[model samples]
Target: RSPSLNLSFLYFCQLMATRGRGRGRVGRGGRAGRGGRGGDQQPDPLNQQQPPIFQQPPPHQHPPVFQQPPPNQGQNHVQIMGQFRVLSPPTFTGADGPQAVDDWFMNLERIFEVLNYSDQEKIVCSRFQMIGDAGRWWSDVWRLKTTAERDAMTWEQMKLLISERYYPYHFREQMERQFYALQQGNLSVEEYEREFTRLSHFAPHMVDTDFKKSRRFLNGLQKDLRFVLSSHGYLTYAETILRAQQIAASQRLELDAAQQTVAQPRMIQPVSVQPPSFQPVQVQPAVYQQSSAQPSGSGGKRNFEGKKKKNQQNKKGGNGGRGDRQPAQQTPRARPP
Candidate 1:
């Protein structure tokens, strides 16, 4: 062989040795080395098991997707409910008047304010409190709404719905009238203010402003209190109430003082006069005089005797004789047999 031929043979041998080393490396770890066909007979791609072509996930098997709630959502809900029940919230049954419904709403609002509840939370809490007729009514109302509408329901909307059902228009009108006619006649200042505040809800437009509220409150006050408060410039409702209370207290004190200072009428003791003593006069018995001579039956005979006697007396006087006149003889009367 020529020198070029020998050089070619040596290059071929080096090439073969490099290829053998490459094959050994592949046989140790490459796919073809792992019990696969050792040659360039690349396993038929069609027959080779490809990594499961990532088969389009079965209709049921979806990609890892996330939902709205976390794994501990139920636990969180239970915790919230536990906290809510601790407040001792009030319930409703639609068995009372419109006022009762309003009171229930007010009570719930107070509790909600303390809890800082959101509108949806308020709706949830309020619904949980409904029972009996109230629960049934809410069910009907709820059935009328779509899921979106239900989810979007706000606290005010819930109140309005309950109001519409339990608090009818006529009843609300009546309450408004009562609110307008409310007076502080016999109620104390605090009591009157409380009542006024409560009824004010029925006619919100009437007392929309402080001036109107003050005016309305003044109008309902007693005549004396109203008179005293009316003389000053406009005041807020609270200020007016405070002033009226002060005036009322002063008036009561004045009345008490006047009562204490007033002197009670003195009871007069009746004068007893002793009656005059009566003196009895002693009466004397009359004495009886008996005549010595009996009466004569003949009146003529007695007259003749009397004339004779008188004549005798005159003769004696004429002769100046001191002779005594003799008594005439009396004739006795005979008794009839």
Candidate 2:
């Protein structure tokens, strides 16, 4: 061989050795791969093409896992007008003392707006008047208007201030009750009338006011009363009224039946008339003999006695003038011949 031929043979032998080693490694390991050092095992194209776990969302991160708030969470801490109204006071029992006027401070705060209390001075003055605290009402108003005063008071203190000034126990109870009813439904003219009738008994003073003003007051009172009552769970007057209506309906049905019974009359019919039958009357023998003897020649009669005797004997012993038809006349005939 020449020099170029020897070089070609050396390269071919090295390539063959490398190929044989790769095949030996694959056969022993049961895998097709290069025997080259430093991990000549390349990534499988299928495995490399898959998306990463971190790159995609987990199954648990679903829409149904979202959270929501409880309904009554914010309801307990509402404010009326500018004043904060706490969670409504618990229900009243005959056991508890009367609710003080300050209990209604929240309600009074709303009333203040109606009276045009915008400034701090006006508001403090108005607060006294709303509670009807008598001397304190005037004193608070004077202090609030003329001087500055800060009173850190609880809702109870506010109610007490109101109770001290204006309403008696009865009046306070009335206000509370009316407010309760108003919350359940919008009042009608009829309901207003009924409320008015009730108030007439306890607060005749309100009755004397003009119908329009009374109506406005009643309407406002109704709204307030109902809200408070509903919160406290004391407003069951609706059920009472429904029961009364049912009783009245039954009574009305009974009354109508009674009236109908009284108004109608029964009728009576008259009996038919029947005529009496005629029967022949017999004459006494004495009267007959006297008449027969006198009738002979007394009244221009010729042989009357003899003819009468013959006729009588003929009727007594045998057939008379129409004796042939006598069988048809079972009794003596009333008609004359």
Candidate 3:
């Protein structure tokens, strides 16, 4: 071979060796380096070292960046519902009367207050509790509203809607009449106050002010209580109620005490004993008279003879003895010898 040709062949062999070594280094790295001379060369998958079947992958130098998906609106609503149900909210059916609807609204509002619910949340929770006819009615109403309208609806607006449906004008009128006519009657102060508070909502215009409220409550009280309370100066409704209750309690206590006094048995005082008085009695003695005794038969014979002679002389001389009538002659008595 010629010398020049042999020299060129050696240079070409050296260049081929350098290129082959660079490819081996790249294969060892398991991937191509950045800014490689070749245009986007891919490493041979077969030549790359495979990780052990059971070996865990290397821990990330920086935690692998993960993009969080957006929150699901339906999931948020379900969570809210679950939280509301824990409070044991009351369910409503349109079959119940207007009073039931009112009571349901009151209860839901109380729960809403406790939970610090927003207006939207209140509307959502209220609609969730409705069932049966009430549910269907609300669904019908809801269907008529557009998305924007429904979203814009406030809790007060919802309440107005419900009221329009369940609480008719006639019913409200009847409630107002009853409220106006309400009297304490046989009801206790507490009970009358409860009824008054309940009915006041039906006729808000009448007792819009505290003074009007107090006056109205006073008017409904029992006659004696009203008369007593009417004499007092202006007072808040709460103060009036407290005073009335106190007076009633005091009166009841007095009545109970009087009844107890009457029911108790009376005590009788013991009578003093007196001794009997004794008086001495006087006695009278009997008196006896002594008679003169005549000598036996002689005296008796002489007296008899004299008495006979005197009697015969008196008869013969009738005119000698005072004027007329003759005396009767006496008979001589025989004497024992």
How many residue pairs clash in all the candidates, one count each?
Answer: 0, 15, 0
Model 3: ten consecutive residues of lowest lDDT: 20-29
lDDT of 3: 0.84
- Tell me the deviation in Å of residue 327 in model 1: 10
Which portions of model 3 miss their true places by more than 4 Å?
1-70, 263-265, 269-337
Task: Name the TM-score of candidate 1.
Answer: 0.57
**How does residue 163 of candidate 1 score in lDDT?**
88
**Candidate 1 lDDT score at position 53:** 24
Would you estimate the TM-scores of all the predictions?
A: 0.57, 0.24, 0.57
Report lDDT (CA) for all predictions: 0.82, 0.47, 0.84
Kindly list the per-residue Cα lDDT of model 1 for residues 64-173, writing each as its tens digit.
Answer: 87767665846766666677789998889999888899899888888888888888778777888899999998988889999999889899999998988898999879
Clash-forming residue pairs, model 3: none
Expressed as tens digits, the lDDT of each residue in 1-337 for candidate 3 is: 9876787677667655645334423334365544353435646444566553344566766657899997798887888898899999999997888988889988998888888988888888999889998899999999999999989999999988888888788998999999999999999999999999999998999899999999999999999998888788888999999999998998899999999999998888978889878787777786756457455589878878887887777677777643346568999999999
On residues 1-337, what C-alpha lDDT tens digit does candidate 2 reach at each position?
Answer: 9876687677567655644444323444565456543345434333345443335567779667567766562342222323422322222112223443334444555655564443443334434333223444445544664222333443445444445544467765676466434422455434654764544444445445455333433344345443333354322335333433444456569989999999978766876778877898997777454554444446637566667877776676655553334566368669986
Please report, as a residue range, the 10-residue window in candidate 2 with the lowest summed lDDT.
87-96
User: Model 1: residues >4 Å from true position, as ranges?
Assistant: 1-73, 266-337
Clashing pairs in 1: none
Pairwise TM-score winner, candidates 2 and 3: 3
